[model samples]
Target: MDETASPVESADCRAISEVLSRVGDKWTMQVVVTLSDGPRRFNDLKRRVEGISQQMLTRTLKALERDGMVKRTVCATTPPQVEYDLTALGRSLAEPARRLAQWVRGHLGIIHANRRQYDSRR
Candidate 1:
């Protein structure tokens, strides 16, 4: 650890960094928010999340499922059906995620302005 870094602070930073690494993905948050509404079949989720490819959606869903943030169910019909919903733990993240989304939308203009100013400065 660096001299400036305490063990407790380093641990907290590592944990926060790990979480952000997981949820910091663009599609992850969108997928979570979509599932927050209700359980959805794979195709429906793909459609609702616009711009995500079949493979990308599949990968993101699988990762979320692996993280215990989402549950996957398969129906036993002739044409098998699959649906995904957030686990209780996953659902608990919705409010903070929603607030983050809202904050981004709210500040995008300012962000763009800052980016332009920074770019011009460089």
Candidate 2:
């Protein structure tokens, strides 16, 4: 067998890979960014993360909670309310997430042009 090293094949960075499996997902990334500002009720979060299905939101939040990146709290009220917020661990990802958003904003034009160029040849 060949022993070439892949970025995620290393034992030391395995934890990061697992984390990425959650945060790297599209919906999770949006949810994290939305909650970065503050806690949001379930419906409010759903509204902020446009196009996300209810099932997908539930699943993503559940996975984030399982990973210790999100905290869920149920409010005591007439109808009851549930909110989600980033935990300390989740807050740690804020800078990286912001950087990622910035990178996308900075590179989107270039990426779109590149895609157009590539598509012209096809």
lDDT (10s digit) by residue, model 1, range 23-122: 9899999999999999999999999999999999999989989989999999998899999999997898877899999999999999999999999999
Cα lDDT tens digits, model 2, 1-122, are 12676755675467777777777899988998899999999999999999999999999999999989899999998799898999999888866988999999999999999999999999
The residue-level lDDT of candidate 1 at 35 comes to 91
| Every model's TM-score | 0.88, 0.86
Model 1, position 94, has a per-residue lDDT of 74
Score candidate 2 by lDDT: 0.89
Clashing pairs in 2: none
In order, the Cα lDDT scores of the candidates are 0.93, 0.89
Q: What global local distance difference test value does model 1 have?
A: 0.93
Which residues of candidate 2, in runs, are more than 4 Å off? 1-15
RMSD vs true structure, all candidates: 2.0, 2.9
